[model samples]
Structure formats: C-alpha cells, structure tokens
Target chain A: MWHVDEGTMNAYLDGELGDRGAGSGERGAAERGAGSGERGAETVWEVETHLASCAECRALLERVKRVRDRAGEILASSSPDDVVAPPFEEIQARAEARSTGSRVLQLSRIKRLAWAATVVLAVAVGWYARGTVFPTRTEQVSAPLAASELEESAQSQEPGAGSGEQIAASGEPGADSREQGAGSGERGAEQAEEGAATVVAAELDRAVAPADRDVAGRGAAAQTQTPAEAPSTEVGAAAPPQAKAEPDAEVKLRQEVVDVSAQRRRSDAGDRLAAAAAPQAVVQQVAADEPGVPVGGIAVGEALMFEDSLWIAASEDEAQDALGGDVPVIPDLPVIDYWTAPLHGGEMVRVRQRLDEENVLELIVSRVVSDVRAAVALRGIAAEPAENEAQIAAKGSLEAVAIRRGDLRVVLRGPVSTDSLRVLGEKVR
Target chain B: MPTDWAVVYRETYSDLVRFLHRKVWDIDRAQDLAQEVFVRALDVDAENPRAWLFTVANNLARDEARAAVRRKKHLVLLKGEAEARAAGHADPHAESVEERERTDAVKRALETLSDTDRTVLLLWDAGLNYGEIAEQSGLKKGAIGTTLSRARRRLVEAYERLEGGHVARG
Candidate 1:
C-alpha cells in the first residue's frame, strides 16, 4: 500500500478531510486540488485506512497534531482581546457622509446625478419589498413626496409666475441666467441608504428605457441619425392602476404598461421622484424675484404629454405644420434643442433646456385635444392620495406644469421644484 | 436577492477587526479599516460576506503597509505592542511585563512565516474554513493542509528558539 503524504495526513488532522460535514467542502477541494470533488473524500478515507495499518503514518499524525495544537495555542495568545464592534448605524452614517461630502464624490458631478437616480430606484425597490426604511430626514422626499421640501432648496414659485420674466431674461441655452433648479444640493447621506438598495435592481434587471436620442442643435453629437426608437423593453413596464397598491405592481407611464418586475424601479417614476426630492437636498439658491415655496399646501400644476407619440427631432415650422399652429417658447430660458414629432393625429414641439449641468427640463407643446395629461402612477411608493388629485406625476423631486398658450397647450417637466415649473409655465408665450 | 446589510454588519464586524488587528498590529487602525470595509460593503451585496470582508481588509492592510513605509514611521513594533498590552493590564507592573514578552515572542515567530504561510495561518485563526481560505488566498484546497502543517511547525520552532535565546542571554 502507498503511504499517505504529509498534506493528506495533515488534512485529516485539520478535519479538512471529507469525513464529516465535508461533502461540499470535499468537493470544493477536489475541484480546486484534484479537479474532482470526489478525490477529497476518497483521499481522506484512503489516508484513514492506510494510517490504521501503517505504524509510520500513524506516528507522523501524532507529530502533526502536536505541532497543530502548539501553533493554535500561540496564535490564540496574540488574538485581539474582547474587541467590541461599533454599532452598524455608525458605519452607515459614515458611509452616508463620505458619499455626500467626500472630495472624490463632489468632483464627479455626473456621479451625484447618477447616485440620486440610483437612490430613487433603490427606494422604489426597497419600498416595494419592505416599504420605506425610514421617512426623509430633511424636507427632501415626502411620502407623497412633498413640494414643501423643494421650497427650502429651490427657487420659489407661485402658479404661472415666471413666464414673462424667463422669456425676457432668456438669452441662450446653458446661460448662467437660469432657474436655480432641482437636484443640486447635498442630499447625499440622507439618500445613500436608498442607493444601496437599487444596486441589485440595476445589476439584475438590465432591460432599459429608450435612450433619449438628441437631434436638435448643441453639436453633431446630438445630430446622429440613430434609430428614433431605441429598444424600450423594460421602460414599458410602468402601467396599471393596481401598481398604486401592489408591491409587485407594474409601473404606469404613457398610458401603456408592460410586464416588467415591480421589484425593479419604474425609470420614469424614479426620474420624477428623485427630481422632486432633489431640490431641497441639492438646493441651488433662491432667484430674487421668484415667490417663496408653498409651505404645507399642495400646488395644483397641470401637465401634458402626447400619448401615442413617436419622440424624435424636427424643425419648428415642421412641428407647427404638423400641429396646424405655431409652437410657443418659454421666453427667458435658453433653447438647447428643438424637437418635433407627430402625436394623436397632431404634433408635439419639444424644447430641451438645462437648469444646470445635471438638471434638465423639456418644455413640450401640442394641440389641447391631442395632449394627454401627465399622470405618473408610482407603484406603492407614494400611491395616489385624495388630496393629490392634481399632483404632478414626477415621483420624487420631478415637477410638471402645463399651461394653455392660445390654440396650443404647453407642459414643462423635469427634475425641478413644482414651483419652478409653475414659474416657467408662466413664461411660455 | 437584496442583502439584509444590517444582519451581515452585525455578524462580521468583530471578526473583520480581529483579522485586521493581526495584520496591522494596531487595534484602533484595525477598527478604522474594519469600519471602512463595512462602509464600502453597504453599496454592494456580496455572495459570501465574510469572505468579502476579509478580502477588503487584506487589501486595506496591504495599502496601509505601503503608506506606513512612505511616511517613514519606523515604529519599534515590539515596543508598541508592549505599551498597548500594558495599557490594558489591571496591574501595570505585574503580569503585563511577562504578557508583553510572551506576545512579542509569538509575534516574532509569526513574522518568520512567508507571506503565504502567515496569511493562511491568520485566515484560519480568523475563522475561515479551508474552502474560504482557498477561495480568498488563491490556494488550492489540497495544498492548504500542507501549508498549515508547515506554518504550525515553523511557528512553534521559532517561538521555542526565541525563548531559548532569552534564557541564554539572562
């Protein structure tokens, strides 16, 4: 009989041999050591049978055990004595602080926007599975996601407030003369917990919303003639009245719902919710002329979208001809891009502009009959409440305001305070 | 599936600290690194959390070692250990001196190990099973036992030699 090697003998001494509660461990060892898990157990038994017959191997086992015991004794002596861990809360708090205020994170402006987006998604998933972990600390996000939070951190607005002012003040797109808008302040720590929750959703569910294909101005980069409709497989998942009460409810947007898992987030819902909550957390500054935020009162803001719309870029005249009327502009805001697309037997003219580097607004125009009002139904997170009848569909920090400009109706929506949306709606002429 | 981070944090924090303490030999520094490990971990849901914590702790300790060299902090490691141990003793002058000597001897023996040997031994002591050690240390499972045997023997011999040297000097 072949004698057992020290490695095998030592394995038996260490209980690493496949004799007890070692099936998987043995198999893992075989895959790692012998390229077959069976070998670990076979080797253990062989060593055992061999040691029983061979005095030499048995003698070696005694020597190995002595060494093992001595080593364990010495190693135990140096072990850190009675180490007490700080509460998990302390670590969580530190992570929040680091994510929000750390220099490295601050340098990545896009990352903050991404993290905010992540938090929205995470919160939706978390809430769906187990409801909100806790209520918002600051006036950031409300259960129905309060507009009062935006009042603290955003440019205040009354219904139909800033149209004339924004139009007169508007010079160019991205000018510093813009609304101190949504998602700009330091909502980092307050939202970091949510960011963690969504990481799973982001990784597991990759079916994505249609990527916005930019066709109007800025550069040739936006001018690329890619497919007008990118794959919108998962984006369609948001539809169903049932979603408001059901954890596994599908997201409802554009009045069409797809069978996307409710465990994942509705991208548009996340976009809107984060946009709604971002202003107070990332407050820019109050523009001197805009009104103060509405304290406890819910602001009734009108919103519109083209339901059966094929979103794309086209010229202003083409848009007007398609809609059988003239498209209006928000006077003071810089026009970043102008897009036109047919909707509900009419046409929609979209004016894309920036509030800041990260916060963007899309001012959309259509004939009143062809326009579908913005009805963002988030599944179970902040389901529709009775007082929220006229609530803008944007979930967190997103706000929408629609106003009638003569024959045309225009709606402005983005990650902004509803008050800001109201003020900008007043500027469209 | 989403990880219940609160449970994982509670279970693994102390083990992470113990593992880190052995690598850096500073309880406070170990605790700080352990906290950082959990902080990063909050953003992720790892399949094997204990293994993940150890892997991160190892990287942090390695970086700390490099940073210490750059700072040129030529700390008398033995003296630091003695002072640390003495600070906790009920009677500073009595058992602490002997405790410090024994600790210094054990630490010196551990230092004699090759990087692979020391890591394997420390990982085992830190509660990793053979499979976890193999996965984390990039060692074959069949080879772990051999490494452990060699590590144990070397540790005992080195400690015995240190004790003998002290006796001869006395």
Candidate 2:
C-alpha cells in the first residue's frame, strides 16, 4: 500500500539495485551487476509490482530516465580521444633511477661537512691507529726492526721539507699531507695493477724508488702483514740499490704522492669501512645520509668539528701559538708539519712528523685533561696500560706505541716494533 | 602477490582519461593526471585498487583545480593564444569543429553544477555503478540512485540553459 520512493524508482531505472558480495562493499556492485541476489530480486519484484499499478511512479521513472539518458549522451561527447598509458617497464625504470638519484642528493648534501670530516678522520684515525693498528704491525714488522735498528733508525730519520711542508707553506692544503696518514693502516694493500701505462710506471718507479736498503736497515716494517703485502715488500727489499718496488714492487712505504693518492683511491671502500669503525656520531651520520651506501662507507672520516673546539693550523709555530702551551716533539725529528684541532681546552696537540719518505709519526702530546672525547677512538682501542707497554691493540696495521709520561700522554705511530716505537716514544719524553 | 598493475592499467586507462579530461578540461592535462595517478598507484598497496585509483585521481584533480584557479589569469592569456593558434590551423572537416563545440558546451554545463552533484554525476559517468558511487561519494547505497537522478536532471537543465543563451547570442 506504501508508495515507492524516488530512490527506488531511479535504482530500478539505472539497473543498479544489487546486493554486495563477500563480507560486503569493496566489490563494485559486484556479483552479477544488475539485480542478481535473492534480496535484489525481491526489491525488483516489489518495485515492479508497485510500478505495474501506480501510473504516477511510472511517469516519475520515465522523467528520471530521460534526464539520465541526456546526461549520458552529453558526457559521451567529452570522451578523451585515445590515451595510451606509459609502459609499466618505463615506470619501473623511473622508480629505480629516482631511488639512486635521491641517495646521490643526500651524499651531495653530506659532502658539505664530509670533505672537512675526511681530514678529521685522517688525523683521528692516525691517532687511533697508533694505539690499535700499530700493535698488529709491531707483531708483523717488529722483529726485523730490532733494538739495534732503533739508533740507526734515529740517525736515518730525515723529517725534511717534503711535500707536506711545501703544501703546509702554501696555506696548508690539508688533504695531501693529511690523507697520507689516511690509509696508512692499509700499507699491506695489494700492489698496483700491472701493465699501468709505461709513463705512469716510469714515474711511479722513480717515485717509489726510495732508499729500500736504508728502509730495511730501518727494518722490514713494510712486509709480512698479509701474504699479498709480503711479495711487494720482498721486491722492495731485494731491489735495494734500485731503492724498492720496480715496475713491479710499486709499494713505496713513503707513498708516492701519486701512488698514495692512487692507493687511497683503490682502498677507498676498505678505508671507509675501517674508518666507519667508531665515534658513534660518524656511523649515525653515514647511516642517515646514505641508506644504500654501506653504513661503514665514510666512518673513516674521523674528525669532529673542532670549531670553537678544534682547529687544524698551517704551521707548527702557529699551532704552538694556538696551544698557548709547549707542543712536545720527538726532539731531533724536525717537526715537518703540525696541524692542531684544539681539544679539551687546548690540552692536546697532534704533531705529524715524517719518519722517512715512507713513514709518518703522529706524536699526540696532551697534558692530562679529564675529557677523552677526541673522535680518535677506533673500535677495540684498549685504554688500559699493559705492564710498561703502551696500550697497543693490533687495530688496522699502523705500528704505534703510546707511553704516558707523568701528566703527558705521548702516542708514537710508525712501522716499527713496540720496542722501536717505544724508543720513538722515548725521544718524545 | 603484488597487484598486476599492467592489467588494471590497460583495462581502466581510457575511462580514467575520460574522467580526468572532464575535471581538468584539457585532454593533455587529463592524460598527464591519469599517468600521475598510476605512477603514485605503483607505490601503494591498495586492497581495492580500482576504487583507490579513482579516489586518488579525484583528490589530485581537486588540487590541480585549486592550483589552476590561482593561475587562472595566466591560463586565460594562454587560452587566448591557444584559440588564436587553433583558428589559424587549416581544418577541412566541419563535423570536427561541431564536435569540439559540443564538448565545450558540455564542459560549461558541468562547471555550473555544485561540487557534490558534479562528483556524483561524474563518478557514475566514469563507470562506477551505484554501490561504488555510494562508497566514493559517502552516500548511502540507496541514496546514490536519488543523488544521480538529481545530478543528471540539473546537468541537462544547465546544458539547455547554455544552449538557449548561445542561440540568443547568435
């Protein structure tokens, strides 16, 4: 007896009076489209039965149908003339490329701080490797450079105005000298690939041709870390008169500026992973900036912003002036170049003295300061003093000896025995 | 298993473009918006992808419209230049021009309807049946019929009003 509503009339007209499927609703009027289910059939019967008798309902349905048809016809006129969606393969390519691009952008932004960070890493790792990597090299190269070689080695020490001082003079471009210490732990890197251009080979031969007999007289500090390293060092030791490293032995213990740079370039991955070994902050930064780049990629960038806290100077005197206190040295080892990043209120200063063209000695003279917050701590650096030996944990591969002389802590890093390194530490005291 | 988007793309592409073309009022922009929808679709995990696509497409269209309104003056100038360029083109078929005029008339009619009414009408036109329309428009399933009936009546009346005005002006 009740009149059918306008909605029912339109529903019947549009042929969409349908029930849902499954737990209902996500399916678009699913099932059989129009009036399909038992519930839908009942609605259809009720609407139709009402329409059969009600002339008013039929007229109303007729009016709605005309309006609907007119709209459908009008909308049909605006159908966009043929559109082809881009191939799915193209979208997939875009996603991959975009993912790589975003990582690059992140690294680019990081470089603003990262370039400076590399220098901090270079110095800090040099300091840390003195403790950890040295003990390992001392075990490997220690016996060769015996106690007798210490005096001979001391006389052999010629910290000349080498490339480091020359660079220091020219506004102290920190990279070349600083990076010399960067991959010192990888002294055992595999020899440069053979068949390098003859011109490059000739230059490296001349450059790598440093006094190896003199270095061996200094001791076999360059060999025996790895089997791969042994062959190159043997080549250097065997070819004494020719210095060391021929077109084959390219292991210049005094890293050929070009060879060292090349070595730095080659060992970049290993160095960054090794470098990423500490200070918590650098690891977090690297992880945040480049999720794709292994979390350890730039941990080797060891320096912290000594801004108001640390500053690397151009000259030793300038560093001394900045320290406002005496910067200790290994006496006769002419302080070729020293850069300082003032820490714990100028309580510490790092002196990088060239032991030979092949070695760098990092003498960190710090007056007893409470704060040990220098980013110099690598993973597993033993802080405890064992008997009378410097707390030497064989870290990477750099040979170092740390001796705390009363209030002063002197760390000596080079390719020498713990005893030989102690002699160097002895000179500093 | 991941949704086979390629299958959905091929099936719904034409309808999506047609739907976007009405909202944006430009064939090129409509196709671009449709591609954008699919591009974003690739990243999401939609249980009901078809419904998800249209919903995202609708929101994107609204955002595009808001941006278009801010750039309306610039668009008016661009439209003038486009009209001039079209006028200069040599068209031999009069039927093509008549088809364009009819589309313009329909576009004008669509712009006059209230947003909800226009959305209800367009959702149905874009091939969403009653239940989908009700879900998309947040209307009761039964009320979708009533909403569509009202929307269609207004749309036709608006078109006739425009047609009569054009006849008078001519």
Candidate with maximal TM-score: 2
Deviation from native of the Cα of residue B81 in model 2, angstroms: 9.1
- Minimal lDDT window, size 10, model 1 chain A: A212-221
- lDDT tens string, model 2, A57-176? 678678777887888988887776657777877766766665675565456437635544654655455444332322232222322333333223222232331222111111111122
- Please give the lDDT score for candidate 1: 0.53
Q: What 10-residue stretch in candidate 1 chain B is worst by lDDT?
A: B70-79
TM-score of every model?
A: 0.42, 0.44
The predictions' CA RMSDs to the true structure, in order, are 25.1, 22.7
Q: What's the lDDT for residue A30 in model 2?
A: 27
Q: Best candidate per lDDT, number? A: 1
Those runs of model 2 whose alpha carbons end farther than 4 Å from true positions after fitting are A19-42, A85-88, A91-429, B71-96
Residues A1-429 of candidate 1 have per-residue lDDT tens digits of: 345555666677777777544353333433333432223333466567777888977887788888889989988877677778888899889889767744432443354455546656765663442222111211122112333333222122122221211111111221111221223233454455544433332222222222110100001111111123211221123212222232221112211221121212333443334223333212222211112322122322222123223466776666666667766776655667778654322446787876555557787776654442221111112112224422333233445555667656666776544555666666677
Native contact recovery (fnat) for each candidate is 0.66, 0.54
